[model samples]
Target: MCKDKIAVVLVTFNRLDKLKQAVEYYEQQTYPIQEVVIVDNHSTDGTIQYLKEWVNGKGNFKRKTVLLNENCGGAGGFGAGMDEVLDEVRRHELDADWVAVADDDAFPRKNSFEKIIDYYKSLSDKEQEDISVLCSRVVNCGKTHINHRNRIKQSILRARFMAVPEEEYDKDAFDIDIFSYVGTFIKVNALQKVGTTNRDLFIYGDDQEHSLRLRKVGRMQCVPSSVYDHDRPGLGERKIGWHSYYDSRNHVYILKKYFPIQCLIMRCIKRYILDMSVFSSNTQQERKLFKTAYMDGIKGNLGKNSVYKPGFEITDRKD
Candidate 1:
């Protein structure tokens, strides 16, 4: 097994049980990770205390965990943790070959890191240098199949039209130029060259934006061998409350930043038409939220106070 030290950074808000499961999986990995940094986003629950106790229970790995104060959103937490890692690298306090960003709700297979190390080692120096981000195939918990459409859409949006077809997706592990932050293992130097997560995004679209920037520096690969189980529902079922706000606002934000106004208009038109076609058979609330969010997104008032604002904080179960 390659003994390359890796800095595993995780961000969590609540979901202590899910976070514990993720950490447990990390502890069972075949390859060695140098350190684990958990950033708690001001959970009103005793998540921090629970994590500290769990770390203490792990004999050798106990000393490897570090907890941070403050509830920076996922994007901000990643930026802060990466900054710490880079500082440690600069001071020679750490000599990690890679940095893995893991979501608190995600768990990788036991041999996931082993596979990553082997795949990384197989690459030539030039190929490694040219690689920006290395991503894994993520399966939702309890599901056997992959969501190819979601993966394709995410990859294309991140690459900003630099993506290739599925046939050309992987050319001997040297393919496309996009990746997701969740369950991703990135080269340290590549991140340094491309810069860290955009704190402004707070949460959504930050990964896509960072991956897009990384393309300017090097290539990104989606490794099918390294698999992780993400404990999140499908986007369609998961869409509710503030998730709608972030999704709609960020879509508009991305369009405004990267596309022409005419393109944005066309995209909005296409989106609503598709929604109307598909959602017409769905329940009234689903249709209402979908329409409202889409209209607010196109009007560039997605994040502003409106009728949609009241629904932003309502849990999906209640809605």
Candidate 2:
């Protein structure tokens, strides 16, 4: 036997083809999933209708779907997905011990679930109970994706809290301060304590924020043996859209909420350099987007920006 039952919470927006592929990968997992909650972020594509038709009391796992009224971005969609899973548990439909986070475009390898389950079995009882999040090594385009684990910088003076050195992934299991939502396993107990992911973020920095909170409740580990693949093609309207705004805004929100005052003070001088280096853009619309985002972030104004919808161009026109 299986001592643990895992559920998956996946959120998608208009990527029906990728969603189908991800579902196929999930079906191939050696370790069985008890339930799967998929949130469709009001895709203009036929995703909602397809999901409705596809989930007809078939497949090895119990399926649940949440169709949103608006496109709530990854952050909101994930929170909604978690809510659906919790609702199913309340209804006694399933008892899920672990919640695996995933996206439409990314998926675990064939033996990914088996590897994670094996690692979980190897841990001591105390360690197993104390582990809040378990992350798998993720690769994209033959390169090690560092988002699986982020080692903390561990200093109040540092503006940023993480340093993602790819070399740190050689260990069988390593302690990590943060784990990305993609390809990570979270304990239901931790969710009961720390709460579901922050939906107010609406897009970016949501994973890091949730990870930091979960760290306070229990240990997070990255198991190199468990690997997943995340190959997000850097194209489409999503590439040219409002992510830059969310990136700048959510970064500031994270800094204010988690960083020490000493770090905040240090960031004062480095903020401009940071912006120019990472967020700098020549387009008039892009510059304005950054400025507006930075302002809202500092003022604690968050959530989906009314003007900056994904796949839509942000223009300088006042009318």
Candidate 3:
């Protein structure tokens, strides 16, 4: 271990069991997490009480929890958690060299963090300084690579990014243009240089936006040795439902953030045409929501959970 303070920001909403599992995995990390900053998006599933118990339980780890007044989604949760770390650094209460963001359903192996830090330790000072984000290989439940690394399509007319195929993953550390937040360990200084995660995004595509913005700061690497299991279905395995709105809306905002309006419109058209079958499967209300997302997205209206909001009360499964 390099003795650099690392803060793991775990964001959760109504997933108490998965949250507990995530905390346990972090606790078991060989490199030892210096601090764990958990942002509860008003889980309302008895997660608060469980977190209280976990905090009070016997452990050598330093942990902090933030219960937001509202459900800010993953983007806002991470933004808030990182803001907490930055505030501590400002107040001279803590010195965080890196901040790792993880979801409630992601569980990193015990040596994953150690391997990530070891890679940094092996780097020369100049190399280390130029490195921005260190990402992990995300494998699905079936132990298959999830193609987490994203690269922007090299076209003037296209405003989208493409994921490298699983067969192409070489199982070695390599540079990438964008990465997801599931097991992303970002340098604190790099985050400071490129601003913070966009809280306005609320959820889907926020990681891509943040990672793309980080390209100006330093290089991003995906370390295959640092593996984590993301308990999520394969891409396109499930029909777009609750997240369709966010995904639909954020897709435009993200494209517009990176490309010109004309290119963005072109990409949107291509995507809309290709996804017509998926859209047709959606119910009337879902189609309406999708249309609203499309209209709001094209207009560059990136608001919070005002249009469609999830439950924030203390309900186990009433949502």
Candidate 4:
């Protein structure tokens, strides 16, 4: 064993059972996880109490938590969790080299941590110098690769980001432009340099945005052998709801941040006129929400929307 210390961090709202399962899963990993940081977004359920009790015993991993007063969404929860790890490291409380930012419902397989570390250790010292983020191949329960890894596509006049195809998951090791928070393992030093996920983003696009920042620091390798199972369903289709707002708002921020020229002209003209309104958003209400989203993004007003919100509270049974 390389004996490098790692910490796993995840965000949870009120799904106590799922949270417990996630922690147990991480504990079951072949490679030891030194600590688990649970960021609770003000769960009304007995999550805080559960964690207090969960940490009391003969567990393989030490448990830590960040209990928020209000729901800051996944982006804020994750950012806080990673920042907590970084702070712990700075304080010499957490002797960790890497931190895995994951969702409450997603985690790497039992051997995943071991495989990922082994692959990293296999690389020559020179090869390892350029690699800072080691991402896992995230897959849904269907045993198909989720749209986890992606290569960015953008230019002065246009921008597009699509995940690499399922076949690409077969590659043992390959570089990618982006990785998801579902199971992305990041080097603590690299995260410190790039900073944590944008808290303003609140939810959607936070992972992608943070991944872009991490990419600038060093190479990100996608190792399918380090398989991650995301216990979720396939995204069916767009439903007109609170999520529509965040999806609309953060997208413009990403476009404007990365492709400024394109965002200036294209997002204002093309996306605003076509993709956002006339077609994508069907109802007048949907259009209104999207319009607010676009305006917020344009004015650099990013954060949890006062009107638009996340619909995750009534969560549990695979819906």
Model 1 lDDT, residue 78, Cα? 83
lDDT of each: 0.66, 0.81, 0.79, 0.80
Model 1 poorest 10 in a row by lDDT: 148-157
Enumerate residue pairs that collide in model 4.
none
Q: List the residue pairs that clash in candidate 1.
A: 41-71
Task: Show the lowest summed lDDT stretch of 10 residues, model 4.
Answer: 310-319
lDDT tens digits by residue: candidate 1, 202-257: 66666766766776787777666777888887556554566665666566666666
**Per-residue C-alpha lDDT of model 4 across residues 118-165, encoded as one tens digit per residue:** 999988877776777998888787676656788877777777777777
Candidate 4 residue-wise lDDT at 42: 92
Poorest stretch of ten by lDDT in candidate 2 = 275-284
TM-scores of the candidates are: 0.75, 0.89, 0.87, 0.91
- Residue 238, candidate 2: Cα error in Å is 9.8
Tens-digit lDDT track for model 3 on 1-319? 2346788888898998898888889888888777888889997889988887777676656778888988888888999999888888778777788999988999999999988988888888888878889888888876745557877776767655777666645656778888888899988888877878898888888898898889888999888788899987746544455577788889887777777778877866765654433545444555566677777887878756465764222122121
Order of the predicted models by lDDT, top scorer first: 2, 4, 3, 1
Candidate 4 overall lDDT versus native: 0.80
In the range 1-319, model 2's lDDT, one tens digit per residue, is 2367899998998889999999989988989999888889999788988999988759978888888999888899989988777767778887988899989878899888888888989988987878888888888777787755787774748755464677777777888897788898988878878888799999878988998899999888888888888977445544334888888788887877888767655664465555434454435555566667777888889887888867556544331
lDDT of 2 at 123: 86
Of 1 and 3, the candidate ahead on TM-score is 3
RMSD of each: 5.4, 3.4, 4.6, 4.1
